[model samples]
Target: MIKKRVLCFSAILSIMVLSKLQSRPQGISIENPYKQIMLEHAARLKEEAKSPRNNSKAYFSSLTFAEASVPTEDVKVKSKLSQYLAKFSFKKVRSHEMHNRADKYLPKIAKILKSYGIPEDFKYIPIVESGLDPRVSSHKGAGGYWQFMPTTARLYGLKVNGNVDERKDFIKSTHAAARYLKSLYEEFGDWTLVAAAYNVGGGSLKSSIRNQKKDDYYKLRLNGETASYVYKIISVKEVIENPRMYGYKI
Candidate 1:
């Protein structure tokens, strides 16, 4: 009788367990909230994948700025990009010397940028800054391929003096630029903001962000030059990478 009682209790317990399991949904756990969230996310992604907008070429052709991909859907960015593309087109441009210089120096600059873990897209900065001319100097006294001012050059370990200015050295200046860019990225946490700070100075850009309560480089109200700086870089990248697309023989 005792054995029979024990067996009957065991059978009842098994039925209860089986009933609970059968009532619950398949392939889902009630205890794991993270798994449920992931399952929902996967379902959402599957639906998005079916959307035609996600499959468009324009969506895929987004340009990368310092490893951050930006869609080309913004009207301001598109307008600025179009202007530069037309300007850099073979028929509109006077000389291909810029392209030639880029071919010569980009390999070394790219290697230095890579060594510092910077994006290769930053190699185009020298092209826009000084037209890849090592001897070029701005009216404000910034010089070299990377265009470091005297004070900034000194700050980055480049010796900038009357007789021996290391800012004119492409190799050294490129390294200095990389260091400066890396520091800016660390502070701002955004490559686009880094480029803006590089143009307008960190203090000024920070002030703008604080006052306007806007951190986005594209949306921020910056000076004319700072506003167009990143777009110019993107345009340069597009033309350089797709020379044939822009009708350039080089």
Candidate 2:
């Protein structure tokens, strides 16, 4: 749960200066505004070379200047997004309700997944899917913790009826989700892509993989939403397991 680090503008500029100083040892430290002074000094040195007799006391005096001051590179600057997210966390509010509702449903979800020998991370599917709200429905009619559409939910053993839509049932939907995730993982052999497929369907995901010529999730070129989706899930998992790492109290 390491916080993401970003270097400051000045720090990056200093690095560029240090890189340019590699060929000239006796001149500018280049880490200071004295860079202009050093440039003038180098120009005078060249002038002295052009006319040897012009290399007088004035030229020698300028070359004997002290080293440029080194500004502290250790200064830590906070990221604006990190600061903003810390001041206001929607996850904190959403997660409170989830934790309460999860107590009544997570046990059932875990039991089904465990009985099928699914990975424990599968428990997070509900959080990413519907925030564990049974009545949740996507614009595409994907419903429940499984977020299965009308056809796919039934294909995976969830019953949808006028009186009782099993997609809204925690136990049945978790099982269906587990089976679907497992099947996608088997097909792609990568959990990250499997999660992406869960969002955008397996057919399009496979097409992306073929078009990119990369089986690895990190290497594939995906749309912005799909690209960040896996990392978002991982970020949520990291935050939940150890909230303090991301400046969360819970």
Candidate 3:
């Protein structure tokens, strides 16, 4: 009878162990909870790898002159980028309108720039120049999306008369800007310098280059606006391309 009882107790213990095993989750070992935590952590990392916020380098690398023109490693460029990133506000920028206009216009601008062998990055100029607003004008005589002064507008095959300002015509002005940028690239042989020349004028940039004996845009001591111009463009590019990273819904 004692032997019978011992056998019954053994059978009951086996059933209890089997029931406990079945009640626990599948594929997860209670003996090693850390392995499940590690698996979860690895999955989270994989998901983060696919997110843009964690892939800023990939975005930067995809751009033309990714390293040469907008060197984020440079102190001045980094500081200016921080300033602009801080300054960028989706509410103030009218994110929906700006993004909608960008979606409408940036492809055309990129096409023109591409036709001229200009870096597609130059398409960001209008974003920095006029907030992509074709009707916007500067305190100076600069007007339109490209922000061309009247004389520069006329020089670049844009009509600047009272009746019609071709600078406000997105397509025509983009073409003109493309041509102007091409000419500037010929002069500077550097897209970064071309951007600087576009901002401060070829003559002023040339003089600065000659006087400072520095051909590098990052090294040149320029007026505040001109100095920050390229950095602002880079910043705009970053904010636009990584809007969610900058707290911009659009």
Candidate 2 per-residue lDDT, tens place, 95-170, comes to 5565556567667777887887666656766776788777889887888767789898888898887877999887
Question: What would the C-alpha RMSD of candidate 2 be, to one decimal place?
Answer: 24.5
Which lDDT tens digits does candidate 3 get at residues 144-226? 99999999999989988879999999889999999999999889898889998999999999999999999988889999999
Instruction: Name model 3 segments beyond 4 Å from true.
Output: 1-69, 89-93
Residue 5's lDDT within candidate 1 is: 100
The lowest-lDDT stretch of 10 consecutive residues in candidate 2 is 63-72
Native-vs-model 2 lDDT? 0.63
Lowest-sum lDDT 10-residue window in model 3 = 58-67
Candidates 2 and 3, the one with greater lDDT: 3
Scored by lDDT, the top model is 1
lDDT of 1 by residue, 132-207 (tens): 8888898999898888889888999999776898888888888999999999989998888988898888899999
